[model samples]
Target chain A: MSLPKVRVPYLLLFPGFAFLFTFFILPIVNLAQTSTQTPIAGGDTGEYEQTFAFSNYIQAFVDNKEQFARSFVFATFSTLLALLIAYPLAYAIAFKSGKFKNILLVLVVAPFFTSFLLRTIAWKQILGEEGFVVPGLRSLHIISQQTTLTSTSFAVVAGMTYNFLPFMTLPLYASLERIDPRTIEAAGDLYANGITAFRRVTMPLSLPGVVAGTLLTFIPAAGDYVNAAILGSPTSKMVGNVIESRYFKIVDYPTAAALSFTLMATILVLVTLYIRKVGTEELV
Target chain B: MATERSLSPEARSILNSQISRRGVLAGAGGLGAAGLLAACGGSSSSGGEDTKTVRWGNWPLYLDFDSDTKKYPTLEKFMTETGLTAKYFEDYNDNDEFFGKVQAQLKLGEDIGYDVVTPTDWMAARWIRLGYTQKFDAANVPNKVNILDSLASPSYDPKRESSLTWQGIMAGFGWNTQKNPKGIRTLDDLFAPQNKGKIVVLTEMRDTLGIILLAQGVDITKVTENQFMNAVDFMAKKISDGWIRGVKGNEYAQDLTSGDATAVIGWSGDMFILASENEGKFDFAIPESGGTISGDNLMIPSTASADGKKNGEALINYYYDPMVAAEVAAYVNYVCPVKGAQAAMEKIAPELVNSEYIFPSDKTSSRLHIFRSLTPDEETKWAEAFQKAQGN
Candidate 1:
């Protein structure tokens, strides 16, 4: 039952390639087909035929440009926030945690034990009007009576940042942990100060992680609907929400597919430009 | 379950209802409620009349369930009597989502994992129109005659051939008693200054817009496009002006409980469950202008195997029994659609015999209006408009 030596690698790769073809590539192809479809004449609600209706993209984009803009804005904010929080924690765990590093890493991933939906819904309650945080802030004159946390864009962004923090932290931790301590000493030996040594030497070495972490955080954040659905009001709706409502609520499969393809294309282009600008050709 | 002599009827009823509420709340944390009754029965199907399993996909907390046993009492009884293994799943959160999940399979003539599905009235219409459901065998469902007169002739299934009414739902104003001391009876009251930015409305287009259309002095039963647009415009303005918080589904109950919403346009059964669970902290009222009434229909999808369909029909027939329907009505507190259920309730839960939510009187019934069925074109148009107003 053993495979020939030359064919062994191909045999080993068969399952992964088959999985990617079936679950990933097949759906993308189907989605692309659906994107170019037109509704059948005298047919049921969700029935469609492939007509290569490229105008579907134009129509979906024009109809949802505001959501498109809001999604990127929120994703950008959440990515920046996640980077600010995750970088320092990952740094501490990598360079300064001594023997407690593994425990810290486990703690970073501890929130994952619970379901993502549950965690997001928990945030909705924690920042809710009746939740202790809001009333406490109100009593301390930190927020006005009319001001609320839940159902606001701020809540949505906060939820996204929290949910995606581990995505940012783990990659950053791996890259930081891989940095040899001697590189920093070499910079210091060359008359670089602590801040200069860290910034010039450490930051460049971790560019791969920064590129990876930001991409991981931003791509999903841009397409997320649950945070907005649970913690945001109507004004904070994202493109993901539009696609969802179109597919389920309105049963507009053509429009939903068009939006999906558009979102995928937009994110791919943005990620390409981002990697090129950051000049990190190896990480992605 | 409460048999103490010192307890008043109201207290006993409250205790009984709380027991059910505990069950619902324990299992209900998110909109995606997936519950399997016992272990999933062995899937290998026997070829002929030996089918011993029935799988039903229904809304959460819709049946009479005992939390401690994690079993549906009526379903358990049905299994014992018919020697059938019943698998019930609380999988229907929204009509469109559930339909979207199985529509492709249904179109391909494949089993969508359930012998029976309970879709709301409008959705059932779509299923029947598309020939996606099988007509019930008249001999198998002999108790179908017990359907209430009002529900026996819905536009979707005039002859009761394909579907049976599961429960009638009335949508109106529900508010926190502490937040709205004066109560919310009309749209104006619902939009009062104190309730600004604290109001939640249903994602169901008919119920939310039906209430608004009624307040605008428009008959929801025959709403014109212009009338519907006006209601949609009004809702959009409220959402933009930060007077309404969210447009949500059954999860709106979370907002009500977490105090993110002070008032909502919600369903009667949910508000009743919330009120009982929270010590009467919540209340539901039919808007003075009237409220929307709809029903979820139980039907066997066409993809079901013949034996599966037969088992499904038997399950449907068992639910149509007045006593069994009354038992479910006592637990869920929705309007019972079985004609003799009220009389049967007098024996099972006497305190709920006259409960307006379960057995509305003439005055209560008069205030409830069924949102008329829509044309397919209008369905897409109106649903798009509704989602647009919600900023999706």
Candidate 2:
């Protein structure tokens, strides 16, 4: 069963290539096909045929523009919040935590042990009207009696940030840990202050992590329906919820597929522009 | 998705003793992933691989489950007596969601991993109309005669050929008793100012819209398209005005338990379970005008193997036995479809024998109305309108 020397790389790449072809590429092709379909003239619900109805994309977009915008807005807010919180946390673990770095890293990833849904639901309870947080704020007159946390856009964004924090932290830690402290010393030798040395040296070096962390956090958050479904009111729903309801509830497969393709294309364009703007060739 | 932290210690224990279907809403993704894994792993069990095996896909908490043993006692008994290995899956969350999951496979004429499935009245109609279901063999289910006369003939399954009624569901007002001591008996009560931003409604279009239509003096059984759209418009206005918190399924119980929802358009059975779990903190009332009544039917899919169909019929017949039906009715607290299940309840859980939820009296039954079956065109169009109203 010996492979020819020139054929070895192909042999080694076989499983990965096969998996991607079957799970990813094929589904995308099928989705593209489905996106252009039209329902049968007199068929039952969910019956569709290949009619090349590209207007489905436009219809889906026009109908769900609010949700699409909401998805991106929520994703952007969560990504920025996650970066702001995770960068400091990851910095402490990478540099200041010293011998306790591994333990601190474990603590950072501890939430993954529980199901994502469970954690999100837990957040719902913690922010719910009966939960201590809302009642406490009300009693202190910090919040009005009518003010609640759960089922609000704020809760949805908070949940997204919490759920995706680890995605931001680990990559930032890897990039930050790779930075040499001497780079900072060299900058300081050039008469730079603590903030300046870090910003000019360490921060620039961690751009790859920022790029990777932001992408990781943003992509999943943008597609997330759970956090919004559990914690947000109907008004806070995102595109993912629309797609889900379209596919399952309405049985409008073409519209759902069109929405999905549009989402993917939009994400692709945004990511391309983002990478181009950030100019991070060494993204994690 | 309500966690233990959302409940009092007492409620948590009660919720633990019974498998609250709403609690497993979190497992929806996990279940889908498991199905994918099974397909990829090539360990998937084909239907009717053996006549001694039968698999049923049903709604969560619809059967009698024992928390300590982590099993359905009636199911275990059926398996023991029939010498069959019966697998039960609470794979159904919503009619559309579950049907969508299996529809592609059904269209391909492939085994959908279950011999029997319980779809609601409308969904059952859809399945039959689509010819996706198999008619039962009368000889195999002699106990079919035990079905209630009222449920014996549905528009979809006249003469009860293709489907058998599993449980009757009543959709009405469910509210936190403490929050609305006066009770919510009318549509106006459900939309009161005090309950603003705290009301949830069922995603079941029939129930939610049917209640709204009834309140507006439209007869559900003869509801016109204009009448339905009026109700839809009313709901959309409420949602846009931020009066309604959510349009949900069984998980509305989660909202009620967590105090996120003060009132709901919820099922009678779920309200009963929530009331017991929370020490009567919750209560259900059939609206002064009326409430919507429907049934989930157990039917074998057409793609099921002959032996699987036979096994499925046996399973259905077993459940129809009044004694067996009584046991499940006691736990599920839904309206039992078995004709003599109420009399059977006298011997088992006599307290529930008089319970209106499990066995509604004539007066209570008179207040329940079945939503008219929609034409296929109306089904799609109306569902689209309903989803639009929910802001989906």
Candidate 3:
């Protein structure tokens, strides 16, 4: 008889997987389930109920369209700005610069040594009314004294940009570093100017990094409350603060969980569609 | 699927090793901890035949415990004399956060494993209504006389039957002297042009609005719908225009003290910290119109018993004893609810005893409107206004 092919030890994954399922997936599932429960007639829980209030999602979209739109606009603008800045640095590191590349790369990664909150707060102070940038602008008369810089949406975007810039830059560098320079030389020799050579050969190759870095920065930036809470004025508060207030400040867990799920679902659908449109072939 | 019978014994054993090692190792730590807990947990405070233990939870850094000093002098004395060991747990930071934690346990009518907890006045009222707490049996507390007469007949708990306040503090405006030496008398100062981008308000929902309503000359005791909109609209305008620096809570003091903030809506005690640190850099002032009032209270959790609860209640009572209360007041630099603690504090720290921030003068006292709970609509309106104002 022929020897039987061995089956994979797939069942072996169950134990480790079960641990993750219990800890991580279970809570998310529970939050979704709790979001569906209807409120009882008499609410000594009049405060809040696990009342599967689907209206929360509607309210999140309709009632607070300004906050939602602001978050999206912020995420989009910051990611685009980051890509503009990072692509050049990534290109210089990957194709142009030599010798001190490792040292420069280390310097790029150095901010990660400090706490994320601390760095963000530092950015806030640096951009405050009396901050280095604002005062310098005032003295030069670039912006007048009464001009509000900190405690606005403008400041929140600035803070988010400062904090997540490295996330965008590092990935772009990683992607660019993997591209073979000879292909670009070949393109240059054929008929291309430096810009054309970059557009055809370099940009396509680094698209994967652009996609990955954009997603990394955009997802966290959209949900960020700390940046908005500290840097933005009251009008600049985002969906994160809404969810936080629903759960923590107000104890309205059902609606909070509902808003949370809505955010998760929307991000998933948008990111997946973005990926398909961009196409994986050019990205790699 | 494995074709185990056809497999070599070693392969099956390795499979078992891979599966069991991680599971068993992970469980191993948990089991060890569980065993260790079982062994030591009882002796720590099982409440055997002779003695009892009471557990209490409070805010971080609220109590005066000198870090360089190894012992808790107050607790040490309580344990020595009463023969009851106090198990203090610093687990609470906010009223709502702690309430959310214990509400489920309370709903199920189970003990949250704490004998006493400290919540502020409005939260105490809500908790009492929900029956999450027990009424104090005054006869059991020998030191009940130390309870302040003013605190005894408050509306939340008539006859002082259930809740008791430990300290009272003024909730008012504390401006940066760097901005104005003329003093910010009315609520109008916060909205004034020169103070724009320099104003700081607490993020707390009720306190922020209470002061605003009072400044607008509305009756804060009864919040009318029209009154709420007027207050919210004014706040909304301030927020939308880049007139406010930022809204914050406890960190308000830090912002003010560092000169990051030129003026702020601040708590008296928190402001005192800045005042004491900066000397003349800051001033905690009660606005001429009105400001909110608040007191942190100690209450018996529902599970507290006649014996275990008595020991815990005595501790609050003990802290209120004239001399003891004065020491705590001076250390905290907050309003002493114990009427005579102010007099006793005067004998020791004359500056604090006379300070209106700590012990409000009669004129300031009359204008202070202790904040009450808002109807759901008021809160949502306020939240909506706050969001709109901040440009969120």
- Model 3 spans with C-alpha error above 4 angstroms: A1-8, A36-42, A45-53, A92-103, A188-193, A281-284, B1-54, B70-91, B109-113, B258-260, B303-311, B346-348, B373-392
Docking class of 1: high
* Top candidate by TM-score: 1
For model 2, what is the error of residue B172's alpha carbon versus the real structure, in angstroms, after optimal superposition?
0.3
Q: Per-residue alpha-carbon lDDT of model 2 for A195-256, expressed as tens digits?
A: 99888998999999999999999999999999999888878999999999889888888999
lDDT of 1 by residue, B64-129 (tens): 766656567798899999999887778777899999988988898877778899999999999999
RMSD per model, one decimal: 3.9, 4.9, 15.0
Using TM-score as the measure, name the better of candidate 1 and candidate 2.
1
lDDT of 2 at A41: 84
Q: Write the per-residue lDDT of candidate 3 for residues B261-331, one digit (tens) a residue.
A: 77888787676565545545666666777777888788888766567577777777777677777766655
lDDT accuracy of residue B1 in candidate 1: 18
Q: After superposition, how far is residue A226 of candidate 3 from its true place, in Å?
A: 1.1
Model 2 residue B370 CA deviation (Å) reads 1.1
10 residues in a row with least lDDT, candidate 1 chain B: B1-10
Per-residue alpha-carbon lDDT of candidate 3 for residues A1-284, written as tens digits (9 for 90 to 100): 74444533546677888999999899999988767654444444425546566776676567666777787888888888888888898878876779979988998899999998888777766776556788898899998977767666788888888778889999999999998989999998898999999899888888899998999899988888888877776767888877776666655566677777878887888889999999867564
lDDT (10s digit) by residue, model 2, range B1-392: 12211112333234444444323332343355434534543335654366687878877667766554556789989988999988677767788888988888899998898888999999999999999999899999999999988888888888999899999999999999898988888999899988999999998999999999999999999999999999999999999998998998888998899898999999988887787767678888888889999999999999999888999999999999999999988777789999899999899876567677777777778888999999878988899999878768
Cα error, candidate 2, residue A154 (Å): 0.6
